[model samples]
Target: MKFTRTANANWKGTGMDGAGTISTQSTTLNKAQLSFKTRFADGVGTNPEELIAAAHSGCFTMQLSFLLSEQGFTPEDLNTEAQVTFEDGTITKIHLKLEASVPGISEQDFQDTATKAKEVCPVSKLLKAAEITLSAVLL
Candidate 1:
């Protein structure tokens, strides 16, 4: 099966003065880019890397949750943070940190499942250039 999303951006002016609109039609990201500072502090449209981080984090967490459930463990909570590092003018690494509380699951089991999830998740598979690293903590 294949899935896809469409987004468009329109920019004007220079780096400091330019602004853009990021839209996904009528979806959540429609016309959503008035400012795009690194952390949205300078009033610029959101950048691609930031959007990639958001997608990776959400996708990885859901994949981990599903994997845990399939293993007959109930996950109390799953927290994930994805750091996208850029070097030499391009994205170089994706660091993933996942913390999950799965009742009735051993640390080893949890870690194993997390490893598989990271390998098999759609976003993880899509990112070939960036190095993907993961840290899974069980509680």
Candidate 2:
């Protein structure tokens, strides 16, 4: 099976003075604004790093659920947070923090699955160039 998605961005003015609107085919993010101040400083708008973090967190949570089900467990809840670090105009690292509640699983097994999820998730594979770290808690 194959899938495709698309997002477009339109910008005006210079880097520090410019502002852009980002739109996705799904329209979930309809013309979200992005600017240098938003990316490099505290400003109102969405940035690429924030978008990546959202994608990674969602993907990782889903992957963990799949792994748990494959291992004969069912997840009651999974809360994942992805932290993207941008330094010197480069994405340097991504940290995944997760709190999960799964029934009928040992802590060690849960941890193993979560680790594998971080290693094998699609987003993790795509962002392999950056340093990725995970801290998972089985609650």
Candidate 3:
């Protein structure tokens, strides 16, 4: 399956002083504000790193669910948190913390499956330049 999704950003003024609003095609983030303060400091609004984290976490969780179903295991819950560390104008690391509840699955199996999902997920592949770490807990 081949498809495309898009999001638009509009910025005004300089990079440090300018502010922008991002709008996705789905309208999930219609005119969401972003600026230097929001990205670097603790300003209110969404930033690129936060958006990456959200995408990574969502993709990984969905991949895990699909893998579990393929392995004849049903997942009750799969919670994943992706932390993207941006330093020196580069993304240095991405850590994925996953807490999952799957029926009829061993700890080792779950770990292996999650690792596979992390390695194969679309966002994970796109961000492969960074060091990606995973901590999976079968709960």
Report the C-alpha lDDT of model 2 over 1-139, residue by residue, as the tens digit: 9999999999999998989999999999999989998888898889999999999999999998888888889899999999999998799999999998998899999889999999999999999999999999888
The order by descending TM-score is 3, 2, 1
lDDT tens digits, residue span 61-131, model 3: 99989988999999999999999999999999999999989988998899899999999999999999999
Q: Rank the candidates by lDDT, best first.
A: 2, 3, 1
Most accurate candidate by TM-score:
3
Per-candidate Cα RMSD to the true structure, in Å, reads 2.3, 0.8, 0.7
Q: 1-139, model 1: which lDDT tens digit per residue?
A: 8876788877788766667777875477877775446333554456777788888989989998898888888899999999998777689999999888888998889888998888988899999668999998897
TM-score of each: 0.86, 0.97, 0.98
List the lowest-lDDT window of 10 residues for candidate 3. 99-108
Candidate lDDT values, in order: 0.83, 0.94, 0.94
Candidate 2: regions farther than 4 A off: none
In Å, residue 121's CA in model 2 sits off its true spot by 0.4
RMSD of 2: 0.8
What lDDT, from 0 to 1, does candidate 1 have?
A: 0.83
